[model samples]
Target: MWLVLAFAVAGGLAQLVDGTLGMGFGVTSATVLLALGVAPATASAATHAAKLPTTLISGLSHWREGNIDVRILLRVALPGMVGGFLGAVVLTSISLEAAKGWMAGLLLFFGFVILLRFGFGFRLIPVPKNGERTRWLAPIGVLGGFVDATGGGGWGPVVTPSLMTVTRHEPRKVVGTVNAAEFAVAVSVSTGFVTGAAHQDIPWLPVLGLVLGGVCIAPIAARLAGRLPHAPMGTMVGGLVILVNLVTVVSLLGGLPGWLDAILIVAWLALVGRLAWRAWEKEKAGRLAVVGNPGVNA
Candidate 1:
């Protein structure tokens, strides 16, 4: 019971973060559950299933707000779904420890990318104005789908930034489109897992707890999203992704000196606290901006 409650709390927190930032629920929930002795396979599968409804709801909200780009979805999500199914099959056959190590490395790299963005502002990549850039969408979809299937949550980390670099859309629009695309990927992957690997014996209590907690608090996150500025919100979300990835990597590395772990933990906490404070201030300022400048729709 205590364990179930803990999982529920973690899920709620993850969902809150994801709802506001457009991603991370699966990664957070799966990482926590994996640490609590759930098998990696089961953890990934259960988290995928548990996050389905939440993603759908959040994606619909973003769509209604005019965030989704249906053209991109058509080009990207189809390949992503296929890739997710293939990735799941591969994950079932891999050794858990090896998968964890690889996932850790990927997460660490993602973190490094975020930190780079923080230290140096986003470096815009020049792409042909013509639709040739969309040619990359299929490959990105495959990679994002594979990562999400293997790591439990990587769609945003891999897909959103890539799309932003190539497409150069507004930050909020990018986030909303990513969330909308993720709904399709998550649904496809979760459906495949449920049908093909039902024998894995998922922890239903924890899954149910996560689903309920996530669903209940998701609206709050959406509200907060509307109240925040795009640039700062992107920065905050990117920073959190990096910090979380760093922690996951360090934990997976296992043999780091105790002092190093302490340092990493402290740094993560400080970074997160600072980002949260900045976000709060930005939200207040954004609300004021919206009221004062009626032209600013965001």
Candidate 2:
């Protein structure tokens, strides 16, 4: 019971960060769950199950902001649904240990890409323009859906950036639209999981706790988002992601000795403490900026 509560609190904090920063929910939730001794597949399933309603709420908020592109959603959703189904099936068949190794590698690659200083960073695929390129939406949707189901999170890391690059939308608009569209994906995939072969592993209590916690914190995070400077906020989020991936890699590779795990946990606590302090400073600065320059507005 207490463990469930702890997981819920951890998930809520993750949701707060994700809601405000435009990313991090899946990775954060999945990592924390794994650290708690849950199987990777089970953790992914539980997280997705819980995220369905939470994403819907956030997506609706984004929609009210006029950030959704209905046409784009219509184009991608069917393929995404199919891909998510397929991915879930695949996950059921895979070895959890192997999946963890692959997931760690992918996370490391993504982190490295994000850390790049210049010249294309991590994006290799060029943004598709109009016509046939837009048609690529189905395949992209399929892959994103599949990976997200299997990995526990890919909306922000895979789908949002891809859509933004392809459609040339503003970052904020992309974030909003992606959040909305992901609600659809999460709902579809989660429904399939509930009815399909993967239903047995569902951790009902923990999942419910996570959903409730996320619901409570989401609005608060969203409200804070508009107040922070984009560049610094993005950098901080990216840095945190990098640190998380590094830890994931070390843990997966058996590089973290027994003694080192304790040290890493302490470091993790310190890192999160620093993040909170920085966020407070940023919020204060933003408020001051607004007060000192009345005409400037984000």
Candidate No. with top TM-score: 1
Q: Which residue pairs in candidate 1 collide?
A: none
| Model 2 TM-score, 2 decimals | 0.76
Model 1 RMSD in Å is 3.9
Prediction-by-prediction clash tally: 0, 0
Evaluate all candidate structures by whole-model CA lDDT and list the values in order: 0.69, 0.66
Provide TM-scores for the models: 0.78, 0.76
Query: What are the per-residue Cα lDDT tens digits for candidate 2 across 91-156?
Result: 667787887765555555544433331111345567665623576678778887787777777656
Residue 270 of model 1: what lDDT?
Answer: 82
Compute the lDDT for candidate 2. Answer: 0.66
lDDT per residue for candidate 1 within 196-255, as digits (tens), equals 673268888888888878877766666565444444544555565566556666666565
- The alpha-carbon deviation from the true structure for residue 202 of candidate 1, after best TM-score superposition, in angstroms, is 2.3
